[model samples]
Target: MWLTGRSIALIAAAAVSLALAALVGIPALLYVTGLCAGLVAVAVVLAVLARPRLVLTRTVTPAIVEPDEPVEVVLDVGVVSGVPVVAGHWRDRLPSTVLGTATGTVPVTGEPRARVEYVVTGRRRGSHELGPFSVSVGDAFGLVQRSLVAGGRDRFIVLPRRHSLDVRVGPAGATDGATRLHPTSGLGQDDVIARPYLPGDALKRWHWKATAHHGEPMVRQEESELRPTVLVVLDADPRVHDHAGFEWSVSAAASVVAHYGGRGFDVDLATGAQQVSLESGHGLQDALVVLALAEPDSSPLIIPARERTTFVMTGSLDSTSAARLLQAVPSRDTIAFVARGTSEDAHGALAAAGWHVVVRDSNEDLEAAWAAATGVPA
Candidate 1:
C-alpha cells in the first residue's frame, strides 16, 4: 500500500501532538496537527502521479580477450512517460573470473538517456557469460519503486597468450641404417660410432658378429638422425595452479611446434582436449587458431603412441600416470617438458621412467629445453 502526501501529513500531525503532550502541552499540539495534515495531503498526491517507466539496455565491445586484457561495457537507459524518475540503481552482472568492482546508481538528468561505461579485465582463459542487468527506479518522494530486469546475456572468450620456448625435443629411439635425427630438420645428424659393449647400451641393438670377433658384446653406436618426428603433448588440467603460467607454457609449446612444422618435420599436438596432427605444409596460422580455441580439460590422454612422443605438461604428474604414459609406447622416445617448480616426487618418477625431463620456469625456456632434449644447437 502506497500513501499519498495528505495521509502522511495527517499521520505526522498526530505524532507531533502526542510529543507536544509531553512538551508544549496537548492544546498547542492539537492546534498545529490540523494545519500540517492539510498541507502533507497535497504533496502525497503529486508524488504518486510523477513516477516514470524505465527501460535499460546494455552493449559490450569486442566480447573476447586474451588473459589480462581489458574490455569495455556500455549501458543505455530510456524513460517512458509516467511519474518523473529522479534516481535509480543498476547492477551489472559479470563473470566470476573477471576481477574488480561493478554496481552503481546514477541520478537521472533533465534528459532521459543515460550512458554508463566501465572496463573489465579478464584474469583467466575460457568462455564467460555476462548479463541480465537489473534496474530499480523511484520517484523523488521515495513513495513508489518499480524494478526491472533487462538486456540479454553476452559471451566472452578469453584466449591464452602467445608463448615462446628455447628447447626442441627429438623423436624417441634410434633407427637402423640412417643416423638418429633430431625431430626437426635442418640440424645435421651426429657422427658417433659404437665401441665394444658399453654398460648403458641396450641389448636389442647389440651386434653379435662384433661381439664374437672381439670376444665382448658390442652395440652399434650410430649418430642421432636429423628427421625426427616431434610430438607435443599439452596438459589441460584446470585444477593446476598458476593459470598464467599454464597459458604461457601452451604458447611456448605452440611456438616450438610451429618452428618445427615450418622446417618440414611432421608435427603432432596432443592436449587434454584433443589431438591435432599436421603434415609438413601446415603453417603457423593453423596452429594459432587451434591454440586460440583450446580450453582446459581434465580428460586422460587418448592419442595412440608413436615412435617419438614428447609430453608437454604445466603441472606435476603422478607415478602411475607417468608409468602408464611410458608403457603406452615403450619403444618411443619420451620427453617430459614440465613446469620448473614441480614437486620432487614428480621429477623422481619421470626420471625413473627414463623420460628426458626438461624443467622450464617460463614459456621462454620451452625452446631451449627442446633443443637440449634433442641435442640440437640453439
Candidate 2:
C-alpha cells in the first residue's frame, strides 16, 4: 500500500478545512472537511478493490544454454477476479547473472489479457532464477496505488561458452582397425553373429549354436569396439588462475569434452578434487554443466596414468608438478596447452618432462587454434 501525491494533498486540504471550522466558528466548514475526508477514504478503498489481479505464466526458450547466448522470455498475463486496469505497469525480477529489460507498461485490449516479451543473455554459468513478477495499479481518480505479485521462479541453466573445434581426440594408431571399430551391417560372416537375445530380436538372425550351448535363444547383433578413453585435466589451482583466467580454462576444458564426448568417444573430466566419466550421449549435457560451474581449488594436480590419452589445460607449470607428471606419463605422450602468459622456464620444464606442449588456444579464433595443435598425430 502506498500513498500517492494526490492522496497527501487531499489529507492536507481536509485538515485545513477542520482548522478553519474551529478558528472561525463556522459549522458550514465542517461539511467541507467531512467531504474531503470521505473522498480520501473512498479512493483508498477503490485502489485496493479495483486493482487488476494478474496471473502470470512465464516461458523461457532454450531453458538450458551456453554463456552469452540469448534466451527469450514471454510473460502471459491473465486477469481473473478484479476490475481490469488499463493503466498499470509490470516488472520482472531478475538476478545479476541474467541481463535484460524487465519493466514495461501493461497493455490495454478488448480482452483482459496481455503478453510481454524480453530477451535475456546469460552472463555467467550455473542455474539462475528469473522471477516473482509484480504489477502496480491505481484508482480511476489516481488518489492511491496498490500492487499485486504473482508467478513462480523459472530456472535457466547456463553452460560454459562452447567453442568450435575440429581436432580429433584419442591417440593415433593406438588400436588396429578390427579392435578400434567394427560397424554393424547386413548379415555376413565378418559381422558379429552371436549375442544375448533382446525383446526386438528377429527370428532369422538367431544364433542356434550359442543358444544350444547356453540353453537360451541368442541373437546376432553388430559388433562395435569399445571407445577409446581420454582424460582432460584442469589445473585450477587458486595460486595460478584469477577470475577471467579461470573462466578461460573452464571453457577450454568444455571444448575438450565436446571434442571427445561429443563424437561418441569416452571422456573423463578431472579437477584436483574429483573426476567424472562423461560418456557420449546425454552425458554431454552433464559434462558441460560441470565445467561451467568449475572453480579454482586448493588441491594439488592429479597426474593421470600413462595408459589413457591425457590433455591438460593450465596457465603455467612449475618444476615440481612437471617432475611429478614426467614420472607418471611416458616421453612425449602427454599434451599440455599452456596459456600465452606461461613463462619460458615453465615451457622448458614441460618440454624437459616430455610433454607435447602447445600454445593454449585463445578464446577468440578457437577452431584455428585447436586445429593447429591437434592436426598432427600425437
Candidate 3:
C-alpha cells in the first residue's frame, strides 16, 4: 500500500520548497533545504521498510471466569534479533460485545522486550474469543509504519454465578422412595393405621388406649410402603431477569435436585433445553455438569404430567395450562416455585387448580419455598 495522504502531502511540500530555493540561487538556503528534504525522504523509506520482528504471545490468567468477574490478559512482545524497540502500539482484538464503544489501541514502549497487561471485566455469560492481536512498529520520525498480526487466538468461557440454599424433599413414609406413602403417625388420610403395643416393643411405643380398655400397654406401629418419586422442572428464561439472576436460579435448582436425590427419592430434572432422570443411582455430579453448560432460552413448559411429585421453577406460570395438567394427573403432587417478580395471580391460579405454590424472592426464599412445598422441616 502507498503512504497515507498526509505523509505524501508533507513530502511533496518539502520537495517543492527545496526546488524553489535552488532556482532562486540562494546557496546556503538551497543546501540546507535540500539536506532537510533528503533526510525526510530517507526517514520515510526506513519507517516504511521497518518490518515488525516482534512476536506476540497472550496469556489470560484464567481461561474461564464467572459473569461480572474480572479477567487479566497479558501480552508478551519480543524482538527476534535483539533490536532495541523504541515505541510501538499493541491492539488486543476483543469481541465487539466486550469492547463496546471503547478504543482498541494499547500503548507499548520498552528496551527491546516488554510485556503489557490489561484487565477485562466479564459483563455477560458465554464463550468469548480473544485475539488476532497486532503490533505496529515505526521510526522516531513517524513517517512510516509497519504492523504484524499475531498467529493464534484465545478462548474464554464465562460461566454463571450460582447461589446455595438449605432445603430437603422426600415422600411421607419413606425417607427416600419413588412413591408417596402416607405417614402412619402424621395427620393424613391413608389406608395405613397404627397397631397396639407388642411384647418386644419399647417403652416409648406405649399407647394408653389399650391400657385403659384391656388393662395393658400398647405400642404404635406403622405400615410399610414404597417411596415417592420427584421431578424438578427448571424454566431457563433469558428474558425474565438479568444474567446474574438467571445463574442464581440455575444453581438453586441444581441444589434442590441434589438434596432430593440424597434422600433416596427417584429424581428427574427437566429443563427447557434438556432432561435428566436419575432413576436408581446418585447422579448429582453429572446433572450439575449438564446444568453448567446449559444456556438460557425462552420456551413454554415441556414436562409431561406423571404420577409423581413435580416441582416447577419458573419466573411465571400459565395458570390454566398448569391446572389442566394437574387435573389430568391428580395422583401426582404439583408444586410451583415462582421466581421473583412473578405475578401473584399465577400462584393463586395454581392453588385453585389443586397444586401447591411457593413464591421466592431470592436464594433465601428458595429454602423457605422448598420446605413449604415438601412439608420438610427446614
Cα misplacement distance, residue 371 of candidate 2 (Å): 4.1
lDDT of 3 by residue, 205-281 (tens): 45567556655343344445333356777667665545655665676676667666664546778777477877533
Candidate 1 vs candidate 2: the TM-score winner is 2
Candidate 3 residue-wise lDDT at 242: 58
Report the Cα lDDT for candidate 1: 0.60
Q: Candidate 2: list runs displaced more than 4 Å.
A: 15-29, 42-57, 76-87, 107-116, 137-141, 147-152, 168-226, 299-306, 321-332, 341-346, 361-364, 375-378
Tens-digit per-residue lDDT, 1-378, candidate 2: 787888888888889989999999998988988887898898777666764676889999988897788899998887664653444788899998788889998777667678888999887887878889998777667776777788688978899776766434322322221222223335555556455442223456577898888665564545442234567788777665657667777888888788667656567777776777865434888778777767788776555444555677776556665564455443244577766666677779877655667675345455554554555332
* Per-residue lDDT over 1-378 for candidate 1, one digit per residue giving the tens place of the 0 to 100 score: 255454566677667776886686567666566666544554456555655555776676777566688787887877664546555677778878887555888655677788877778776666667777777755555544556566677766666554443322343342331222333333234654343432123457577777677665455644343344567676676655366666766776666676567655557777764777777637545554566666677676666644554556555555555554555433344566666666677778777766677776654555566666656676
Clash number for candidate 1: 30
lDDT score for candidate 2 against the true structure: 0.68
Ordered list by TM-score, greatest first:
2, 3, 1
**In candidate 2, what residue range of length 10 has the lowest lDDT sum?**
173-182
| Off by more than 4 A, model 1 | 1-14, 17-56, 79-87, 105-113, 140-143, 166-231, 237-268, 276-298, 304-311, 327-334, 339-355, 360-378
Q: Each prediction's Cα lDDT score? A: 0.60, 0.68, 0.58
